[model samples]
Target: MADKRDYYEILELGKNASEDEIKKAYRKLARQYHPDVNKAADAETKFKEVKEAYDVLSDSGKRATYDQYGHVDPNQGFGGGGAGDFSGGFGDIFDMFFGGGGGRRDPNAPQRGNDLQYTMTIEFKEAIFGKETEITIPRTESCDTCHGSGAKPGTKPETCSVCKGSGQQEVVQNTPFGRMVNRRACTNCSGSGRIIKDKCGTCHGAGKVKRQRKINVRIPAGVDEGAQIRLSGEGEAGQRGGPAGDLYIVIRVKSHEFFEREGDDIYCEVPLTFAQAALGDEIEIPTLTEKVKLKIPAGTQTGTYFRLKGKGVPRLRGYGQGDQHVKVTVVTPTNLTEDQKELLRQFAGVAGESTSEHHESIFEKMKRAFRGD
Candidate 1:
């Protein structure tokens, strides 16, 4: 007993650790060192040590006794009562680690159907305005011929003789601590609780059939890319009179050639000729719905952004529309006649000392305008 390590040290917990903390630490260490999961030679030995520590620390009475007397032989009644006082602890620990040993589940109970997801790609404009379309999907549904009974036309299924409709059986084992009872699905009826003598030809005793179903989905207005629309009770059919699951339509919007969207706002770049940018002009800009005229202010520099209020996409959740932002890019002429070049040279000579100075002046003005100075 003196050679045994302290329970708190085995769990890597302080003496003042709470019960929840102790359980969490034990579960972590147990999973890490469990022989089935960990292949190391010492894993099984470590797992046993962790289990022993947990068995002593997890119980309030055992913990108090161990805290006062340290490790003592169970045959000597640790403190007062015999080892038989701790009967159901190991069963609970087994259920906690292995799962499905807690209690029996009803095989005939209604279970919600599995949810389904479908990805659909739509045009960019369709995402902003929303659209309704029908799509076909393959899914399993209750057998129409047998009405989900898995039996022949006139015959019904019989209760499983092995499990007696409970759908599970108990396996008793004698462990080192005591006898442990574990519950498992019955092998006779394969946990369905019923045996079909004459199976339905259509579903082959499965009680379900696969079919292509067409369903109409309504995409809400202003739904963006990667958005999802859910249709209630439109997925795969449920079993044993259960409610059907939901169908989720995942939206994938195709990229637009002219516009980019951010949240509800729209953004697009428009090219302006040097003359049009210098002298100002009203040019037609294309939006999601129609073309609108945007006035270019004289001396509008490249990369300058202009906001058009209430011209972007409509808000999906609330009232009012987002503003459209237009970025200006001044386009320099590549092809110029000798006479035109001479004329531009004469204009530049009269305008400033160098073109660099003019660019500096324009850049300064752009900075001031951005700052609202």
Candidate 2:
């Protein structure tokens, strides 16, 4: 028990996390660590840890007990209540939802197909304006020849004589409390309750085939990175004529070379010459759509930000657009000619050491600071 990890920490949630938050975290982590999806060695272990945490936190009674005393003995209950009163653990809960424990399941029952996920990377501008494209995916589909029956064409499936079509077998176990009967899938029929004498050639008796499918996807305007788009009935083929599952597309937005976005606002830096910073000029600035003229004020300091309204990214929510911020950096003149140097020296002599109130320079401020003024 001392080596066990905290439930909240396992789910990456706080102690006061809501039920919805706990469930959401569980679903995300489960998908990330599912054995079918992730082939890593530790994926199954991580998935089990996530499932155990969710099992305890999902039940109110169990959650309260865990909150009070962390990681109690599995065979014992709180204050010696005994294991029988503990109400099933993770296996029981999983069985209840996935059709494994308690009652017998029909082998021919419809089971939903497994959901699928695809990650797509788009340009940063594409995220701002959005685009529509087609994607190819490999997925499983029901066999056309057997019509999802797993039997050969023109033939039908026969019921399993072992379990009497119940698809389950009863195992009686004697415990300290009493005798318990547990239901398990029939070994003869493999839980299908039907036997295929002549298997389908196309599907190899599996009742499904793999094929490449092309799907069209539409990305909405102003979609950010890590956003998801869902496509209904686009996952793997279901079993026993069940409905197909959905497909999830996760977005990955590529970085832009010129612009950096925060929320809807855009930021960029532009270089200005010393003459342009001192005498102010109308310079051309690049926007998302086209070039726009920006007026730099006289005596503008380096790192001064200028905002261009409605020049940033479009809003994903209600209305309008965001502003673009431009930071100007003054570039000093270099490799000056003798004539230009003499002219600057004469201009500096006339300017003297005095600094103007409205047009203060960083050098003047530093000098005044050194003099303790």
Candidate 3:
């Protein structure tokens, strides 16, 4: 096996990262390296690494084992006794619940359609304020001619001869211990328990046809990125006359040019000149909907955060809203004019860095005032 990187390092997280932190990091990394979204040459490799790390770290037991050993042999882990043993775990569980080798599936029974996932990218504002929009999706629909029966209008399906309408094929495997009997879906009948004698010309006996459909979707307000909404009976048609599957709309919110979000709270950095930092001023700042006036306090330091209550993104389901944090960054003058340079030098001489016999430090004076001393 190849030498594996630490799960924590792979996720770009510290060893003391919390579950929520791990999940958040994994999601961000997963989105960056997902093969469907990212087309970089190393994207697939990076995605696999992210997935493996999440798998180990997300589980407490696995995380404990990994933390102790640094490298746990996957094959030797609990329940990973052997490939064959683990493979049949689900089968054994099913047998335990429903009894072994009995209650065979009736292929003609109603089977729910396969669920479909559609990833949609929406604007950041649109995500904040829900929008009702139309979407065109191509999905499998029951054939009009055959009505999902997969047979001609006049002729019906015939019984499958291979499995005698049971829709299953039995396989006997001889192992060193004993005989392993397995029942698999019949290839001849395709698990339907029947075969169409005369196939429908429109669907060619598949019982379904691919067609484009228009659907209206209502996105609720305050939905964040990676949120999902399920639409019932919107996916591919089920086999025969069964119910249709659901369509899951996975959201991807487009990033705003100026804003970065954490939870419902939004953050933006505003640059301030030395004069603006020293002298209080009223500045216009952008919010999700409108521009608002932000009051800058005198002597504002770099990286000072001001919170505008109820000015951020709306809560997903609950009432009220989050706050917008404006981080003030003091920018130094880039170029100096002759007069401006001379004035600044004079100002610096007057406002010396340290307190002297003739001058008292402004910082110490402010501190004394705050302490009421």
Candidate 4:
């Protein structure tokens, strides 16, 4: 019989190697001495020896037992009961580290459900004022027949035989340093450690199915585009008994026609007639609220602005409201009748003298310029 070497010494690690370090060392060694890759006479036996070392050292309980007794024998308390007994706690550790030892499966663990995202477009007005809207999204939901178990209603899953319920497979490797061991997830059971003998017909053994669902969402006022709203527990159903994921509703607001928004303020251009610009008048202007009258002061010039207090969109977070800025654009008359032309001519003759302060100031400056002062 080959000498029974200390498991830790075979893997070139200390007795207190961390789980990550042990797993890393095992992967490196197993790849080197794998029988498929190495054809030497003692390659197979060396591989098995490396596997046995890793199988014990990778597990805390098994390592503790080996540490106390100097050997892990089936006769030892809670040991795997000799080689290939498949009852040792090492199997569970192997499954966890290697994904699933190529083995049998366990059936009773809860799995998390898949998450879903839905895009929703809302009108600008609706987004600013808040509205309740309905949305439809395609997603995977839990199967009603199997209750997300993937197994038939009355049936249960069985442990995988390949990994012997350990969910991992052991392999040996040879490296420049020496021989080593490796552990990997079982190919047969994946990493779950269980398999469904009879799959659920409703979900076709997937535990979930694609379906269109209708959800009602209440978009709060002042919500901007690209804002995401999360609805908890509304995504795909979890496998086995795991909790469901959340549904993320991404919002997209449409652009408005006449009004442009900046933060909480609303901006718009209001055209003013020549009469309104020259002879100040109070004119009705459109706002988010009903039309409000704005006073145009005498001698108001084009491009002048008027503000309506509390007439803009409501602030999204803070108190109070933004003011509506109305940019006045003076519109000159185009078509003139013969009578209108004659009247304008008479008015121009009467207005020959400078009456406005600006024109008077310009005339005085010109006189000084001519006098060289």
In terms of TM-score, the best-performing candidate is: 1
Query: Which residue pairs come into collision in candidate 1?
Result: none
State the RMSD for candidate 4.
Answer: 11.2
Candidate 1: stretches off by over 4 Å: 1-101, 353-373
Q: For each candidate, what is the lDDT?
A: 0.81, 0.81, 0.80, 0.73
Between prediction 2 and prediction 3, which has the larger lDDT? Answer: 2
Following a full C-alpha superposition, what root-mean-square deviation does model 2 have from the true structure? 11.8
Candidate 1 Cα deviation (angstroms), residue 272: 1.2
Off by over 4 Å in 2: 1-104, 174-178, 351-373
Quote each prediction's TM-score. Answer: 0.81, 0.67, 0.64, 0.63
Q: Per-residue CA lDDT of candidate 4, range 1-373, in tens?
A: 1356767877789977899988888876765666656778987566556777787787788777788877645455433324333332333434544566645354446777777888888888887788888888888888888877678989977888887666667765554324444566778878666787899988877778889988888887777778888999989878777898999989888888888777777889888776687788998888886888788998886678788778777677887778888898766555878887566556655878544545543335534653658
Q: 80-111, model 1: which lDDT tens digit per residue?
A: 22233333333344556778364445898888
Off by over 4 Å in 4: 1-109, 164-166, 341-373
The TM-score, computed over Cα atoms with residue i paired to residue i, of candidate 4 is 0.63
Higher-TM-score candidate among 1 and 2? 1
Per-residue lDDT of candidate 3, residues 1-373 (tens digit) = 2466777999999988999999999878876776556789998677657766887889998888878776655545632212232223223324433445536668888777888888888998898889999999999999999998889999999989999898978776654323445667899988879988899999999889999999999999899989999999999898867899999999999998899989889999999887899998899998988999999989897779999999988898899999999998876665678898667657867866543547654444545654658
